[model samples]
Target: MCIIFFQFKPHSASAYRFILAANRDEYYSRPTKPADFWENDCNILSGYLVADFLTEEADGLTYLKKVSSEGHLYNGFNLITAEFNNTKGDTMCYYGNKSGQEPKTLEPGIYGLSNSLLETPWKKLVYGKKLFTDTVKQCNELSQESLVEELINMLNNEEFQLPAPDIEEQGQDFIRPMLKEISALFVRTSSYGTRTNTVILVDAKGHVTFTERTMLNPDANQWKVSSFQFELEI
Candidate 1:
């Protein structure tokens, strides 16, 4: 599971700015130019170590200091555009240009949402390094419309199969207590033939009680039929 924790802090000017600190396990969607990059929707820089400045006695201290002295490490309120070398009349990899300003060599591959880093100095402090890519690929099953037809046909012919007697009895005993703890539920349906992976959370009372994964065959109506259901704890 890829989980992101968004820590928000209020801004001083009443504008829509926020202080964002996230730790995520999933790959990010890469951003291309001409389209404004959505930080929440895409990944940060390809290679950024937030823990580099954390400890005084760490291993990469000298190297990080050298990189920091070369240029500004963070920018606010704008996306990071590639930096150029004006004197050399050429583009440089380690440097980045901000709002058409002169490029500065900070380090290679450190990026984030514009203006997000300034308020949170802790963001620059990286304690470890990891190799990762933030790219989102288009779904491969998009063009095959026949997948939906197959699902509809399967649902129409299949019979409902209940869980084993022992599991069913166990469910009866545990399901009620689990249902009280669910927080929310979501029902998602993709286009005809498209696959759907959905999760439903139900809180019976105050605690999480029931969780389920319902796989369904896509059809025009709700009778699309349930392919499978599993009980879970929150």
Candidate 2:
């Protein structure tokens, strides 16, 4: 399961307007690529395909709501969409088919999400949000480099949370062990584990800094780090 922790303060007078850290957990043996700007669209940066359906006329929340209407076509996913506007500040929204909740705009605040849903209160999510809150509080004290380093370190945390009682009672015999193993922010199993960690910071001046750390060779523990910075056109 993947996890994300983010704070949105678009109207803040501080150095940063938004901060996010995420981990993509998957089988180590699965084919993967590092984060980069898309070849077809230089304006978009991601490890995966940039959704071409998102038109310039429509904001992220609108597009997400359209997707939600067809949510049955895809597997369960927790999707968060944000649109940052210089004139209008920023808007963020969350939609998840698993929770059966309607798409709704989110106010400026810190939040955590995992496989289950947004703010599901999974132990790891709770712990991660607390860590994220603490990091955000010290943003003014840390340099941009230090902030990124701290967020990366936060994602690398390996402390495991005890499985919730409901999960233990409800999970199947074969699934309980797997759930326990994945309770850590940094999941490390024999085959499946956290393969990538990404940190994104968007400053109040519309400057964006994106950093990604990806495991290149899981067996040898080899990894690659990439960073990019650009000013938003807006």
Candidate 3:
């Protein structure tokens, strides 16, 4: 399971500016691929990683310190997009719902996204919706610790399940089993589950904070965490 939920700031000069929190759930046996800034001209660059003061051009634009996720290590169909200040004053962004099978304009507003239904699972969507909405509503300041605590709680909401759609209906399934709850932002399928929980925060001042918490030894028993802070060079 892979989820990407962010905030949208339409109409404003920094409109579509976003703060993203996402998780990747996959089988441990699936040789996991990592994230990095665009490297060689290979297909893997689609889900790549970012480096400090590093820059690479892809998707028709140059990104400084750009990184991506290839879903699972072996292979998967997923690419995440977060708008950033690429060129000091560039004002372009992805405004439609291409992640879905069809073309649809997500009405301007605040929303979250999950791997199940890319457009914020309309099933258990409210849970996610509320999670983000309350976050924006209540929290006066968004820090790495606050984001971690908030997201960890959200990911551990086993009871939170979107009403599953019918089989053969051509829709993704939203079934997160209620197992021995361990971590705040992870799940386990005997051997496979959320390998990492990431929080990316971009404030109104062009400062960027990226934090990643990964499971050590592929076991949800513990987390090895790291954070990076930098200014988005315009």
Q: Which candidate has the highest lDDT of all?
A: 2
Give candidate 1's whole-model lDDT.
0.23
Determine which window of 10 residues in candidate 3 has minimal summed lDDT. Answer: 60-69
How well is each residue in 1-234 modelled by candidate 2, as lDDT tens digits?
Answer: 789999989767788889999999888888888988878879888876436433356776787788789888888877777777878768888889777777889988898987677887877789989998999789999999999999999998989888655445544674477777777898888888889999999998889999999998664288889999999865
Among all windows of 10 consecutive residues in model 2, the one with the lowest summed lDDT is: 48-57
Better structure of 1 and 3 per TM-score: 3
- Ranked by lDDT from best down, the candidates are 2, 3, 1
Error of 2 at 24 (Å): 0.6
**lDDT (tens digit, per residue) of candidate 1 on 1-234:** 111111121221221111111221111122212112236533222223332332233223343335445546564222222212223221112222233334233332322321123112111111100111111011123222232232223222212222223223334664333222111111112321112221111111112111111222223242322222222121
TM-score of 3: 0.63
By TM-score, is 2 or 3 better?
Answer: 2
Among all windows of ten consecutive residues in candidate 1, which has the lowest summed lDDT? 127-136
Task: Give lDDT per model, in order.
Answer: 0.23, 0.83, 0.50
Off by over 4 Å in 2: 53-56, 165-174
Candidate 2 total steric clashes = 0
